[model samples]
Target: MIPSSRNWQIKVAIAVLTLPVVFSPVSEAQVSQTLKAKESEAKQFMGLMNKAQQVYYAEKAGFTSSVSNLLVNVGFQNKPDTANYSYSIGMVNKAAVFNYGVSKQANLKSFVGGVFLVGNDTQTILCLNAAPGKIKPPNPTNTKGVLKCAAGTEKIAQYNYF
Candidate 1:
């Protein structure tokens, strides 16, 4: 009688623990929220990079060629976690080019993004060839833009999905 009661209690405990996983909308919503969070981070990181570039270009004629230098100058010991993207900056076409996206450890299968921000204080915008985010391209020819880091028909969708 004691063994049977113990087995029954164990089964009850298991069912109680598994009930949420078996029938819960919370997990699905959480996944969607996480994806949205990553996208938000990407946008915030772009703004941060733009600020850093502003400071760098003000002192120098051109943009910094290194991401580490820019981060250090901007007073970050490491990339902030508020964003889910890693950043790399360089000089392209005489423009400060900032690229930030998910790292390999963040996505195992594939990471489909590289948002290119090119411009100085006088002129800059997310490149036309870059992900437009449903907004029309400012420059279809992309010649008026001083910098570009994308090619072909690639488009960065919401959540940075291809």
Candidate 2:
């Protein structure tokens, strides 16, 4: 026996409603993976900057604020902007720092100063971006882990990004 037309319509409606439920988790996972990739890229950039600063310091006894100097002179010529991130290795108050700007403007609210790492003579300091447009606990604080930030900044402890 065949089902009535009314019954078939009810089944179709149920299937349509359930489609989103099945796909929602997949969408969320995709986004999470993408963010993870972006974070990895950011950390890689930080490392490259560290090497470049070392070279510059070895030659000049201090750091340069120009990203161009890091890329052209030291030969770390990777793309400055990734698919989901843009960044600059520069000076804040004559101190060397690495700043990251995300493609998602909404995320900017959570990533104030777009800076994740700062550096000095012996160690690296992870700047805490707790507030919008400002990094809290000040520089040289031992909150986040250590990252080898470029020269011209403050540092004291070792921390890991992953």
The prediction achieving the highest TM-score against the true structure is 2
Q: What is the alpha-carbon lDDT for the whole of candidate 2?
A: 0.48
Which ranges of candidate 1 are over 4 A from the true structure? 1-22, 79-84, 105-121, 126-141, 145-162
Please, what are the lDDT tens digits per residue for candidate 2 over residues 91-113? 55433444333344333211212
Candidate lDDT (C-alpha), each: 0.47, 0.48
Number of backbone collisions per candidate? 0, 6
Per-residue lDDT over 1-162 for candidate 1, one digit per residue giving the tens place of the 0 to 100 score: 356988999999999999998868888788767766665566556556656666666666556757677778889787543334444553445543444433323321112222222343433333322332322222212344433334432333322111
Stretches > 4 Å off in candidate 2: 1-4, 92-104, 108-120, 127-162
In candidate 1, which residue pairs get closer than 3 Å at backbone N, Cα or C atoms, i.e. clash? none
Measured with C-alpha atoms, the lDDT of residue 124 in candidate 1 is 36
For candidate 1, what is the TM-score? Answer: 0.52
What would the TM-score be for candidate 2 when compared with the true structure?
0.61
